[model samples]
Target: MTTRTPLTRARLATVGAELADEVGFEHVTASEVARRCGVRVASLYSHVRDADDLRALVCLLALDELADRASAAVAGRAGAEALAALAGAYRDYARAHPGRYAAMRHRLDPATAAASAGPRHADLTRAALRGYGLDADGETHAVRLFGGLVHGFVTLELAGAFDHSDPSPEVSWEWSLTALDATLTGWSTR
Candidate 1:
């Protein structure tokens, strides 16, 4: 017989996410998570199958939150405006929750991946591309391009890769978005 802890699964996951931010997702452990939550390791086992399951939950939470933000950011907008909004939202989320963002990139199981908010994210990106008058292949290309640019910028920014620049990160981000907008608009299907 397993004894459940007073803390709920949601609360445990939240604590786990915070610990991940402090100690990194790769290093997170059920023992550490238990300590952070003021509970025994055995108690946590009732709520989560294992460290991997907890990590998967964190990834799902992050993806859902990101998808919500992206949806709100791009609502009723189209073309460059939509693109900029989506990019900015993504950057903002990544900056605000680096650990959660890292968790979202983990290689989840196929069933978990299929049930994730990733598809909603893709749909949002696709909707934004509709303003560009792109074909199916072009839309796919645009999504990849946008993902690359956003992820690259955020990764570099988090690693302090642009700390020595004269222009602020914000300035660079805006300029990058502008360039992206132009590139998408002029993309040739050659």
Candidate 2:
């Protein structure tokens, strides 16, 4: 006879996040999560509709954490300073939490995305670009450009793709930021 520990959506989400960190987000399962919590698979069904729901919750959690980090990094900063800070904050967070970082990219349903921290992320990006005086299209372009740069660079960095290089990634990262700043400066008021 086993005692069933009480579970909540929050606890289930936390456990799912931890499992993701251990076994890759794509491989995390409700059954495994239940195992970790010493509960039956059916027990998790009550807490989460299914595995997808668990992943969605983890994704939202990761996005929220990232928004918080970006908010702190960009606070009281503007223009290139804010851009660099935001980029660095994202890079640092991704490196620190690879699993959670991966989860942040997971696609959420429209309604789920509306309620997720993803909007805050977009707003922060727009805020950082405000000092450049870009038109709506320009801001959109810059957002996509910068977002792609950060995500691609971090993904490559984490995959050990830079391990063969002689230039330390630290140096490369700074160089990339410098280039990004220069590009933004050139694009401003254009």
Query: Which has the greatest lDDT?
Result: 2
The residue ranges of model 1 lying beyond 4 angstroms of the native Cα positions read 1-5
Worst 10 residues of 2 by lDDT: 181-190
Which lDDT tens digits does candidate 1 get at residues 1-190?
Answer: 9775567778776886787677677876888888887788998889888888888877888899899999999999998899999998998988888888888897888987988899899999999989887889988998999999999999999999999987999899999999999998898765
User: Which pairs clash inside model 1?
Assistant: none
lDDT of 2 by residue, 90-134 (tens): 999888888888999888999999989999999999999888778
lDDT of each: 0.87, 0.89
RMSD of 2: 2.0
TM-score of each: 0.91, 0.94
lDDT of candidate 2 at residue 160, scale 0 to 100: 97
lDDT of 2 at 98: 82
Which pairs, if any, clash in model 2?
A: none
Clash count list over all predictions: 0, 0
Candidate with the greatest TM-score versus the true structure: 2
